[model samples]
Target: MGEKQPNEQLATWFVRSGWSKGELARQVNRRARQIGASHISTDTSRVRRWLDGESPREPIPKILSDLFSERFGSLVTIEDLGLKAVPNLAPGSGVDLPWNGSQTVQLISDYSRSDLMLNRRGFLGTSLALTAGSALIEPMQRWLAPAPASGGLPTGALATARGGRPPTGRISPPELALLESTVRMFRQWDAQNGGGLRRKAVVGQLHEVCDLLQETYPADVTRRLFQTTAQLAHLAGWMSYDIGMHPSAQKYYVLALHAAKEAGDRPFGALILSDMCRQMIHLNRSSDALELVHLAQYGSRDTATARTSALMHALEARAYANLGEVNKCYRAARLAEDSFTDISVPLEQEPDWITFFSEAELNAENAHSYRDLSYHAGRSEVYALQAQPVMERAVELFAQDPDHQRSYALNLIGMSSVHLLQKQPEEAAASAQQALEIAIRIRSERVNTRVRKTTAAATDEFRGVAEVIELRDRVKQELPEYTRNQAV
Candidate 1:
């Protein structure tokens, strides 16, 4: 050839992946989105240009390294692409786990520092591939293999333990108790308010907790303190996801998992995995979600309480529903239902976090599982018929708890959508209006989004029937102000 190709490495991967230039471009665009890139316009021409001697920019090269690394089972970097690299940069290896107490704490502390100080885009861009084999799998595998000891302090933890920095006092039980109560309060607020509004405060709270973790504590103190910290991090990660800050959510969840491992609490670790399943399911990564759900159940087999195990199985049902595996969904659902036989024990014995795993909550989860099948499996008629009754049951169960106004509201919305799928316009309108009333009162984007889904449903099915028209108009008219109130 008169001139050798500039990106022979990329070309080789393109061929090996059997991807067209357009396909490669598409993959890169999706990769860009994983890091919150909103304006990328990568296309076939971009790929061709890259292969024609034009080097990619700072993030693209880093992004491609992740893409090809996942694809080819090897680390492929900017230099590998035969392109001039960004000055003094190489592909980053992701979180390595299985370290003893010292290393694990250091890993999380360093992550928070980088998280707080680094450019948000670049920081998120690097960690987007946590789902890739190396980042998530290895750490989870290490955690699952053997539980570490319960209360080992980090190196020099004792010497640094005396200063309290939030407003300098030592990390004491009262301090730990305050964090616990704060997380508990946030949980109730999350139900009433939703994750979007509360996520920033939760993130800041987690930063404070991480600061406390840098200092040393005695064994019993470390155990309880770290466990509480893990819970706080999980809450922060969860709220981050609800706000749609997905990469940041992933970061906090990874930190939570590390802290949970350090706390030597297998059950809580399982719970963190279960919490992660929610984000994974929302992202449409059902395969990964399924893996996580099973991991949650298996990892906590010995330690997770019955209600907790039931919740894990229920989560598995949702993952299977996404995969269109109806039988598995029902099977896991039944196990979840069966796991709730004992419910009257002292709440303190179990993490108060699982308090939401009440009968109503399990029914709500089952309702979602059925709802998921109806939405995604193309067996809508059959599944919607099943989902309507389950959702109705969930509504009834929720009504038993006066404080459960949020889940009750959501379940009714779910029922309305199921009714619309089943072609019951009258029932759908009644349920939608009720849900709208709930949405009007709650400060939650999630509630509004659900109502909007019903609005879209009625609009799409336009028979110009008085009921459908009226319901659709009401939702559309109200949603604009409602969404503005919440999102803003």
Candidate 2:
């Protein structure tokens, strides 16, 4: 109906495939017949139209995805090809369901399949929209629904939901152990390097895990498998978020939550919700983030450890801070510190996934809270002064761990923000320079964004100072498009 613009993404894939337009049309028509779309017909003109920005009906996109995947010897998605599916073929359209159902597999499988092409789709100049905070709340509600009067949801529940597969050929213990170790390995890599490096590997393993879920296993093995799957999905989601692929990250987090539910791991599900809340806050949906953090705390009330509780409380503080509620934020921050001090269990006995929430991590969250409050709470110097000591402590702790280069860099930016508000131009520029160096090394858009944002703040605070000018020049060289004119 509108002016026809070229679909360069599809054109690029077509050119890479090295096939004539006629060759593609013939393959589509042939694949259509093979798939029983006998009434369908495609000619070279149809292919040309698609390249000219016309979306073909169903079956064509699927066929092309399959064909290109084969030709490329890797997974290719409809999104990677830049083709919109007909309404009936849309992903997850009718499959949203309760956590402990066959639909879990479908949801994970569909999402992972699409995510395999996530890195490739960037060139398409489009992306899936982020799921709203309210949409994520519904899944949390389902997760928090009361468990059966029995100790837990019955093992038969999983079996029945899985459509009663035969019990033989259960997954071996060694394979399950390997899967778990792989998850831990991936988690560490994500914490060290940014998500951009190994996100695809995580997504690829997740796809295979979904296939394994299709087979019946011993009840204990089933739960373990689901736990492993959930952990992998969560790591994949976090990685995606680290690299700024928000929609994909949200999808992976939701899948992780459902898988955690199936595994009956309430504490882990709450963690996923909190992470989702963190993402929402980063996207400027702090109001929604507040709701999500509340849901997380309530849902995990009985199951969460002291450290996990502290983590949730810190996130609550972050939400309140972003909302400019200084009193509430400070109160929540104290609660976090108190919760940390009250840890009854030994650090080594806590869940491996959450053990990373050490004193340093808490300080990092607290510093961000204070930094945000400095701006929004209308007492810039006062709150920034409050942030300075904690921010410095976080940077010092993170500096001892070279693996957490990204976190180290980001905290430096936060420190720089504090200094800028305190009218310390030299200190702000120094911290900004340190963070920029790290941002240039790490494969994280988040860090780059932090660098740009800090540079923007320095630009506003110091104006034309030679030191600020030099920082601007370096930032412009590294991020050419984000000059002084851009507000970041």
Candidate 3:
């Protein structure tokens, strides 16, 4: 018989096995656990990867095949499972990498060691230019899709303190260092390059950190750690938005929001939701975005600091602008501005999470809102010019801080794109090149995509210019294969 086609054979097997994707994952995980592989967190994407001819790394394939064989009363080799060699899964592919359950556990166990290395001053350079493309963004987009409305709280709601121990009690100093270090690395990558490249690594790291924090830390520490992790996750999600990964980014943001809530940090939680709303606006789901912004504002009313409240209002203004609600946008923008009046006082007692939002940051946000409104009203020239200086200052102020990298990169990219639109090729190319350099250093797909878009736009303006052509070609060459595949 001829070799079975990939999709048909996989579909047939799925149908014949009387197993849903979730069931398969559960079975695989259960078997792996019985075999002492306790680190497995199997999900639908794992099954999807198998269907796509991607095999699990290490003993996972063997274990999974064995589990299936035992149940089916048939010999099921790795080949039968369509995994002879590990297929090159994309960044978000659900397949377990070389690390199986055991390895995962080991990695988490050794988190402290890694944390020490990561947190060392100036451990990683901050100049690598990363790229963000559709590949990164699409997954985030899917993840960020609006959750179905329900009366009760979500499944991942906070629970009472377990075992009469605090969630953060188990965290070692080294582990804390690791968390801070990773956050720093991600921030630097985001600022210099864009969110595209560093986002995946940040998310993965956040997940690992979250797992460790939950298992080992005491309550207060766990709460704080989770809040930080959630913030990183949300930033990753925002990068996902820049690269068009709406769904996956959405999921990360939602998860981050939940994490913030679990930390009893309502302000941070609201900030995350507001960030999600920003993504919704980018996706042109303006109405949905506005609703989310409102939800954030309402939820955060009690505890939100001036900076946080300003950010929420600014985000709401952006969404309103996107929807062409000029009056509403203006109102929100004015509120955002007013919120900033008290920013300095709050900064003295500011939480760690909102420390990045200073007066300059507030001004930048105001500029961003104006830019958005201007763009919507077809006054692009004025807004575009106004945005440039504000964003430039913002980037300059944030340059030294790794935590603000993603935001800086984003603003730079936006500023560069605007420059391109304004026919300022030299400025555009310079900004694009700087962003590209940052994107390369960071491991984010979304930042790369934004760079690509900026470069692509620049190409339109500088078609015959050698520098622009060279830059465009370089970006094209640097784009990840998966991104190129999606584009094709």
Clashing pairs in 1: 157-216, 164-168, 164-169
Clashes of 2: 0
TM-score of 1: 0.73
Question: Could you give the candidate ranking by TM-score, starting with the highest?
Answer: 2, 1, 3
- Against the true structure, candidate 2 reaches a TM-score of 0.77
In order, how many clashes per candidate? 3, 0, 69
TM-score of 3: 0.56
Estimate the TM-score of every prediction. 0.73, 0.77, 0.56
RMSD of 3: 13.9
RMSD to truth, every model: 7.5, 10.5, 13.9
* Candidate 3 residue runs with Cα over 4 Å from true position: 1-244, 345-349, 378-382, 385-388, 395-406, 461-471, 477-488
For model 2, residues 1-488, the per-residue Cα lDDT tens digits are 78989999999999999999999998877666544466779899999999999988876787787577546634456887898755444656322455553577768887777655533534111234444545556656777775544345423335634456566545677888889989888887777777777877888998998888777676677778788888988988888777655656777888888788778888998899899889878877788789988988998899999999999999999999989888999999999999999998988899889988988889999999998898786747888889999999999999898867888898999888888889887888999999888877666777787788778778977887888889988998985421111110
The regions of model 1 sitting more than 4 angstroms off are 1-135, 147-169, 400-402, 470-477, 480-488
Model 3: per-residue Cα lDDT over 1-488, one tens digit each: 66434554545656778899999888767655543456767899977876765646655766555555434533344555565535434432221222122232333324323322432221111011111233323332332233233212121222223443333335677867777766866665555565545554775676576566545444455555666666776776666555544444564565565445445567777777777676656545677677777777777678787888888888887887777777887798789879887666645577655666665566566566666766676756766776677677766776656655655566677767667656788888887777777676654555665777678767876898777887888888876532311210
- Cα deviation at 324, candidate 3, in Å, is 2.3
What C-alpha lDDT does candidate 1 achieve relative to the native structure? 0.70
